[model samples]
Target: MAEQMGSCKYLFMSLLMLFQVVQCRVLTVSEIVDVKLPHQPKSFRIDLVHRDSLISPLSPGNISSTARWKRVLERSNERLRKFQLDSRSYSDKVSDIKDAQAPVSSGTGEFLMKLAIGTPAVSYSVILDTGSDLTWTQCKPCEDCYSQPTPIFDPSKSSSYSTVPCSSSLCAALPQPGCSKSSCQYYYTYGDSSSTSGILSYETFTLTAQKLPQIAFGCGENNQGTGFSQGGGLIGFGRGPLSFISQIGPSVGNKFSYCLVSTSDPPSKTSPLIIGSAAGLNAKTFGFTPLIKNSVHETFYYLSLEGISVGNKALDIPAGTFELDSGGSGGIIIDSGTTITYLKQSGYDAVKQGLDSAVSLPQADGSSVGFDLCYTSAAAAFPSITFHFKGADYVLAKENYLYHDSTGVVCLAMMPSSDLSIFGNFQQQNFQILYDLDSSTLSFAPAVCDSL
Candidate 1:
């Protein structure tokens, strides 16, 4: 039900409460080095793969931008509706919702990155999900698996592969575990009824030639699903213990940043995901904002959305419309996978009403038929829209965050949500966003992602 862009099927993360066990390595280990990249000595770049990219076999031909936006809004609402039905509760229930909503590839999610795992280092196109933690892939001896275009990872062939013993600390952290005789078994089920079960093992995760030793991930042996067949696996960047970031945060200074390009951009070249010591961006350019930690699930990067200003005027929206609660149900989250922004009803009304009043022209696109895009003959004459984050005043330029359709329509790439609000990827195009775990801060600056 949670979709970056969204797919036909709803994905659910199986993290049932565990009854535990016996063999694996401890958490801390030897220092790992960054891979040698041609540029940016300490930094490496990973290309951002768009959804249904023309270069990708799963993608159809380029559809109209108008059609794509329509689909995005529709998908956003559909997921939110499911979320409403699920009805976020206390911590445990909220975690279930997050798992239920996690992205599993297909046509609806955001960008995909080519990541490598194991000794021979097999490259896998994994969907990047900031909301998720466990990085997993369909592995060899796969009794059950999806029909992936790429080869399944064979750990037996990789020299660095090792099974995480049922007794390791990571096993304790596993949200839901199925007990087995020798090793830790993981059985995950998506909301759509798709499921994957496998062993928790240690593998060398390669990012840009860097052989990160002792990285723990799920070796999915029996996976039955209809979603995310295009890629080999999923990459979790959440704050949980098993996430790639949490595992590597110590060596990389607890900082990572990505400048997202438009999914409509050319597939050959797009944005880059930067990590390690290289993530110390210029503070003056990319101003900092204190990130709110979720009491329920610490994995999400929450931010307090104070208010919004249209034409340099702060709208008189209801107070506390964008509050970040410890429960994690309501709040604004900056997500990498979601394509469009979603504002809760109160915030939406204030912003929409302001924009409607400021713009002097009629909607050029189809709104009567249910669309969020708007148009104006004097689009330039329209005032600017600003988002007030805690301790920051982030600004959005027209072309940077808005889409100017072929029909000369200036559309707002955001809409209203009945449940939680999200600041999506479309609003993040060409901007560098840094998540510093150690400092508990999130920062952003305008960037030409294609050039970077």
Candidate 2:
């Protein structure tokens, strides 16, 4: 779970950066040519180190007796009631695939991770993204390029930098509005509104011991988002050949897995992303759930939920009404692009009543949540809510699991709609979430997300 959250933080930050640099111009290389991969084989390797320990078991000493963990389970029935209609808009479309099953929890585990990339220049701290598919970075001739913390990947400096001719087969697949000729040019737009422009290029790339045969990326002539300060480039996770994982996937392991840590957590103990066979889940030791492919968005996974229950009482929500996207958070956005999560008034009332029983509250506005439970003053006991799905229960920790702008502040991160519920990262902490594209299933396990 920690690892997944770490990846989510990267994605979220990328979105935020994208929103800030929406209308930047891209510089183009003078040479117009066909796009093709390098013919030589380049190799590299990476060393990884595990930085976190397993979470201790929940026990009497670890929890407060006065307020039982289960007692804190509350349903914002009223909030959910009002948002039901909106929730439907964000709800995931059910899949017809036989293996398409709802998300389930197994056991806790961890993995070793190493990310490497070959750029036109000596690129440092280039960001890797599992949620996107195009790999790109700021380059020379960036007349209006914004300043950033990391150095740009200059193709001209690299001994191996080579252009992908316009006629190459790889250039045909660039996700552009008019991808007709081989005049390889790419324009990418991220959810947060970050945009980059550059001509396409084919290069021999290396990640650890693995070397991808042919890879294409958007070499931005100019870029604008510099807040991240870590990398001037983005490695996309989409299905194109330029995407980071897909290019090396068949070689790295057969799949990749990530759990992003919440931004709210301290950065020192930040979680690391994992890929390939190094992923800690031992199939032989842990349970396996069928992967369900999404019919509508071929890139996403779909699961049929049985229900969600808080202790003995099951909230009255339709099964198969929610969808989880591992790439998104801040809150669960069951968005198909348009609708938002709508928690009905009844659901919000039920949830709030339960939460209010254990924690005090401050007034609220649409923008922020103030708190009654002060983390600095005293520790507050919280309830344990089980997100029941397909007969399995995924447990959530109190601190990282439920979050507010401030402690005890009553605000609408989870807004009231009508009847539907949308779960995001606020509810995703301490849970090992696995998005398996090969099997088409979103899996979860109990975890100590403090590190992620």
Candidate 3:
């Protein structure tokens, strides 16, 4: 009878363990699908929809998966070329303010925001760019302009629109400020040779049902570029004084955060772009890394990437491989507009070698898919990649680093760069990334962006 009781007890214990394992698995799946937000109120919240989303104004409707992938690669390559040129330009500092040039790009960003301008407010869709510094839109009286979906903004219709005089401090802040009979004139040339010429003006900007008056922006009269034709204009979120964030940073405590939903998820699921204090941040859950400063090029956010690891083994890379030199070269930048992560040639080589050794799957040709490292099997288990920032260790999920093309090709979502390394939006998906200007640090935590 004692032996029978002992056997029954063992059976009961096994059942309890099995029940707990099932319960944990269900909880984990639910957490991934639907993340709960903190109860605290957000200061300013905006919906950031992916450009490919059906609800977005810039959505490319019902294209083949292959065509869509090709387009994505093309845009990423163009943006990467722009960054490479910009790095050289930053190193070659010009003493004279007249010769100062700012590098700009059009229609390469993956996210779009719907914002209103003027006193009565005219709604327009614009590209969101962290790499750019000036907020601009196509204006009326077009000598040369691209065909945008929305009507051009006519400053004459807005009662609150006023051009900035050349003598104003704001006008002088422009890289290459011009004067057309006392009115401040601005000309911006993109890396792709696209250009925009217009008058600097102050107008009321509306975001998320809130009115922000006297925001300085460009009213482009002569804008010639295929990149600008896709959307109404571009909104700059760089660190420069004229950027939208810089102009409003003081009021918003110099803090901003964004959570990008995974591209694999439904495009209809929108991400959250928080402009003030972010919710659900703590020391235990979130990791912090210091933001390295680049006096020459202040617009880009630089970070010190110590090393990288594939699975559990660290890559054999030389020290200071990702360090920023005094001349503003060889640093990693976190960019919201870029789609894929780019690494310096040396670093890229090491990472690729590491991934090749760890992923035990048959190799596949990726040239047609726009990737270098690819595998044939989609169901094969893959190792996670971890980025070792100064004080933070960000471990990426398999979905973050591996791109499963619709044609049954699984490829690594990274590339080699000849210039500066970039931490692009693809690697940043599903993480709440907070840029704290006041603390000179960047904090991030894993999250389900759609729920946020």
State the lDDT of candidate 2 residue by residue for 1-452, as single tens digits. Answer: 99999999999999988976863433245321222335422222232111121221111233331121121111122122222221232333122112323221100011123333454324343443332456766777775465654566666766556666766656665645223254577765322223466778766565544455456776778554322222345555543455666666554443544444543444334444455555444333323344434332332223334454454456665333454434321122221111112344555455455544545544344232222222222244555555554445655445434444333332323445433344544454445555444554455664554443
Candidate 3 residue pairs that clash: none
Assess the local accuracy of residue 132 in candidate 3 as a C-alpha lDDT between 0 and 100. 85
Off by over 4 Å in 3: 1-42, 90-104, 278-284
List the candidates' TM-scores in order. Answer: 0.82, 0.58, 0.86
Superior by lDDT: candidate 2 or candidate 3: 3
Encode model 1's per-residue lDDT on 69-110: one tens digit a residue: 665655455444433332365454446545655443222356
The lowest-lDDT stretch of 10 consecutive residues in candidate 1 is: 14-23
Query: Could you tell which candidate, 2 or 3, scores higher by TM-score?
Result: 3
lDDT tens digits by residue: candidate 3, 117-221: 997899998888988888999999888998888989999999999998999877887878999989999988667457788999999998888887788999999
Full-model lDDT for every candidate = 0.72, 0.43, 0.84
Best by lDDT: 3
C-alpha positional error of residue 91 in candidate 1 after TM-score superposition, expressed in Å:
11
- Model 3 global lDDT (CA atoms, 0 to 1): 0.84
- Deviation in Å, model 3, residue 256 alpha carbon: 1.0
In model 3, the Cα lDDT at residue 117 comes to 96
True-vs-predicted CA distance for residue 296, candidate 3, Å: 1.2
